[model samples]
Target chain A: MMNEQRREFIKKTALGVFVGLGAASGLVPAFSLEKTALPVWDEKPVPGKIRWGMLIDTRKCKEGCQQCVAACHHEHNVPAFKNRREEIRWIWKNSYKNVFPTADNAGASKEIQSRTFLSLCNHCADSPCTQICPTGATFKRWDGIVEIDYHRCIGCRFCMPACPYGSLSFNWQDPRTAIVDPVTAYPTREQGVVEKCNFCSDRLIKGLQPACVEVCPEQALVFGDLNDPASDIRVLLESNVTMQRKPELGTKPSVFYII
Target chain B: MKSRKLLWLVTFAAISLFAAFYLFSNGEAETPQKPLARVSVVDSTKCIAPKEFMRANHMQVLHGWERSVVRDGDRVHIASNGSRFQKSLGTCLGCHNNRLFCFSCHSYANVKPKCWNCHLSPMETQ
Candidate 1:
């Protein structure tokens, strides 16, 4: 009986060691190693995986409404300089004729000629600004958004003229001095860098919509993933006729307007 | 000839004594006292990392964070204890809000970081 008891104890000890080894090796799901992974700001943006685009319904957009421009400027801490040459603007309005010069304009209405259109960075897929930027400061993000790393910009105006749309502005003087009311959420650009709309990439990372889109009372602006067929912007594109600024330039602009 | 040799030796000895006196007097001159680096924490709480680690390598951590936040677009930094913090100078200023917290050490070390050129410091905000 003592001999049997010794044999039983040996069997139990061997089984216990086997279980411990299995746990250590992660063979058992409950014993898997727990890693403290960082809270990622979305997955690393992959090219063509998500193309963030915007659709603006020009019909609903009011003529005198500066809410979108105000909201964008305030959120980005874009200063308003007294000199027009030294002024910085992210988003602004322009006459339809100026915005869409290539579009058929022979029989356009009087109101159409006078109508103002929202103008900002096109965030083009084949952007000339990104191509001409000597420093990799201004480039297209993997998700199809054009962004500028102000820290990397060398104040070269190569991107300014390369862009068909006058979307970029240079900070000739200290922008902080001109800021009427500064917003601490975003940083202001230094005196010697080109600034423009970033499509609010900062907000997108925080799971918030763009400031302009959120503040528009008319809901005229629609932003979504262009790659997703089920996205609201895509649905709007499918149901309505849309126009892109300077489509002939082959920039492949992501911003669409429903006239 | 012996008298001339003695006169030359006397001249050399006089020059040597003057040079030694100048050197010793310069060495005894008092140097200006070094400015003391004093940091007062506005919010005294547990830091993201150990005090020793932060004191030794805070610059490295900030630079690593700058690259991650600006270039890679990874804004969240998870501490060893699993607490999440935004990877910005603002986060550091949130706790060490005293005006001299950064400047005191930076001035003491004679370093001039250009972080405030673009980013607003607590002093500017106030």
Candidate 2:
């Protein structure tokens, strides 16, 4: 009888101790016995199920129009440098010859030769940048978007050269000094970290499209889940003759150019 | 015997002088007043957690939030009070907009955090 009473006492004491610890650790509400509601702002990126991709219709992109570039830079607080050598860009226009050297033809029409293509991070499936990062700072997200964790990047510049697209930029000096009308929404990067287009992961979580896609005057850019058959990007990809940059390299870029 | 007595006398005198110097000199020097952190403009009760908990584990909380929001893309933080907040420094600065509050406490503690190096502090906006 005494042993039974002792067992009951011990079980109750253990339960009380667990509850106390939980309350102290802020895992459980102290006064309120009600369960806390889990407020989800957006859907979590599930690996392989949802792959975010982009389709850029280069034919629709107008010449000398940098609205998308300007919007991306401003939205991300990318510093402007007058010196071309020191300039940083998340997205910029490059000549077709430079962007797609393998596909370029000298005998092509002047319109095709001089045509500019919007260039940014390809966010490759088998990305060399993510593979070469020594610190694992550059990584492919579960949603197929490649991104860098600024906190983990050691400024080794390995990812910069590993990325064949030249999407990454290093902060040589204090970026804040060069920023004009700084956007408080995004944190400015410190010197010595490599930063690139995050596909606006911050905005994506808030249920907003990428800044470049949203600001495109001609609606040349389309962003949607590549894995979803019903997604707009998938429909565009199916209907158009899209080309990935340096397909020979087997990067399998998510950003496709509808030439 | 006389030499030993002389040595003891000298030792006693030195001890007496040292004790007197320490006690008197300490009282003569005025201790600088430590700057107190100003209370945040918002009600203290509105904090995500209790005042004592936040005061002790704010850094841990912030670091956890940073990792989850940036790396894992978990943006929503559910507070113990069932209030949801976006896991960003902007959310904190929205209410505690006073720069003096942060600086005063940090200066007093002699801890210089590099959060403001990249993040836009309330000081910069003001």
Candidate 3:
């Protein structure tokens, strides 16, 4: 009996010491060593299996088609407004100079005046938007996809000014009233909230291509895991002279464009 | 007795004055003059339908556009000529352009049909 009481006392004293140490160091509350396993879903992308990315082959992309843009808007239920001020876009085409200003200026001596390119969220490995967001609403997932949780956004617009690519947008008006029947694929955002491209996280979970990728007739868009040397994106990176947006900013964007 | 009464009255007045000042100042400090945020309300009754259509698609209208039209219930009415309408976008742009708030999504969606296609994009692409 006495031995058992001594053992109990020792255990209680040890636990108290651990808790005190944790509190002093600001570590999480101490708990027992028993490991609790999380339930695994059959469809869950094996935690690090797929790193979503995009490669734009400007050579194959036809100017003015805007098919990718239409498909993305249609799928996401983006509103169409007549006023330029009320317009919203996820992906759009720009003149070669717009997409690649540095390269375009360098190529001014060359003969191609009609060269055009597509631009969207670069989904950088070192994303500035994620760092600047006061609320952790914007974040990069484990698989290298930058995403936003609309619920946590406070509409501070700090991320807007921080982003060099101008990929973010704020809901000046309540978005619920804009569309006939808002697309139910994703939750609609409220007024005074900021939003941006999430690389279509919902579609990725289903093992499907991004809306833009599915609709590109010219096959100008490529999506894959960049970490794997065997992946198609990796192969393309090896073969093509592709460049990222704003390398000087050191964002290291996953989206690459072949010149 | 008179001196005692005067001292007591002076003390009471001082106490009352301090209490009043504290109460009023605290009340004013606690009540914010401007709210942290202002959500625009839609006036549905004053909304104007598109000229081509009797009613504009719900998505086509700006936020707070239909607030004036909302009656006792969910039902709303629109003007026959589709000319005069209250709009949240208009109110928002009174101080700033809609491009700051809308362009990223508009460009992403690529739904530029009427004014968007013809008007200059705010984004200064090279």
Candidate 4:
């Protein structure tokens, strides 16, 4: 009889300990918790607020100047390549047909024959890259810049493939070997991280123009807030024949081209 | 009977203490912090020309005949009719003269012209 009582007590004690552990280890809370709180913004977007964008005048873009491409590559510490396959560019000159094949064949008059295009990130209003990211590593800032948090990125390369314009590039090797001293405006990313044109967001925050914009000799590239009707970009769009890349994709790209 | 009860009490106390220690240690594990994202920008003030001047005259300054002579100095001197040349232009001569080399490689590859696509003729004489 005494052994029976001891056995019963031991069983009860063991069961109690097991239950306590399961509760303390978060197994119970996992099934019973509410949603986590996220950071919220309260400011209203001004009607004429800046929605920074770029306008490339393809007619004036010289075929081989490569000044914009070289400047962007050097400033961003983009890797050099021995072949076309390894080439990575944040901003590059593209042919009129390469960037806008449909438009090129639209039977426009010969007056538009001189047109060629420069291509880069569109900085879309409703970016699909941000939507497909498993983690919130890629996000669009309120100011219309699409940015990536490198440390949070798991190097899935999803963003690279998802981008319609081929704007995003994955770091196949360590980025450090590309430059002795990387640009201080942005921190350098490591191998396996994805990167692209950020519309020079760090410069925008500092009240400076993008490197490509400042360096273009033809004034082919114009950047300003789209939300502000009076901004230079808006004014230019009103005066010139402008179009966006891949408008059917419904990305609502902020980058425009004036032919 | 008394001894049996006393053993049960001691076992329960020990079990409770062990459970408390396990819970406390598990709670002390550090949570990882998220890394901040970084963006880069160029300093306009670092350039030699004013922003407006640089924006307007960059192509002319980059692609003129003077730029070619400045870039390939050895070739220029060898091809020259006389030994004595004019004055030294500066380091900008070497760095800004990348077009000759770049264009040579680009031409060999039969790649589409990159310069004339986005800019006008660099020579004021043109």
Q: Highest lDDT, which number?
A: 1
**Residue range with the least summed lDDT across 10 consecutive positions in model 2 chain A:** A28-37
In terms of DockQ, the best-performing candidate is 2
lDDT of 2 by residue, A136-226 (tens): 8998776778989988899999988888899999998888899997777788888888888999886776557999999998999999888
Give the per-residue Cα lDDT of candidate 4 at A100.
74
Which runs in model 2 stand beyond 4 Å of their true positions?
A: A1-44, A104-108, B1-45
Greater lDDT among 2 and 3 belongs to 2
lDDT of 2 at B25: 45
The per-model lDDT (C-alpha) reads 0.76, 0.76, 0.58, 0.59
Cα lDDT tens digits, model 2, B64-86, are 98888767776667688766666
Candidate 3 per-residue lDDT, tens place, A1-259, comes to 6435644564677744432332233232222111111111122122334456899987788867889987876667565655666555667777766666555365443434476677888888777788778777776665667776664678888988888877777777765556444443344556677776768765654446899998999898999877677778889989998888778877778899886
Superposed Cα deviation of residue A135, candidate 4 (Å): 0.8
lDDT (tens digit, per residue) of candidate 1 on A107-149 = 6777778889998899998888987898889977766789898
Residues B1-126 of candidate 1 have per-residue lDDT tens digits of: 999999999999999999878644422122232222222212223467887799789889998987776666666666898666666666676565555566544653468877777776655664
Which residue runs of candidate 1 sit more than 4 Å off their true CA positions? A1-43, B1-46
* Lowest lDDT block of 10, candidate 2 chain B: B34-43
Give residue B111's error in model 4 in angstroms: 50
Candidate 3 Cα errors over 4 Å, as ranges: A1-49, A108-113, B1-126
lDDT tens digits, residue span B1-126, model 4 = 999999999999999999878644422122232222232321121234454674566456545423332222111111122222211122232223322323332333356533332121121001
**Candidate 3 TM-score, C-alpha based:** 0.54
TM-score of chain A of 2: 0.82
Off by over 4 Å in 4: A1-49, A109-115, B1-126
Error of 4 at A103 (Å): 3.0
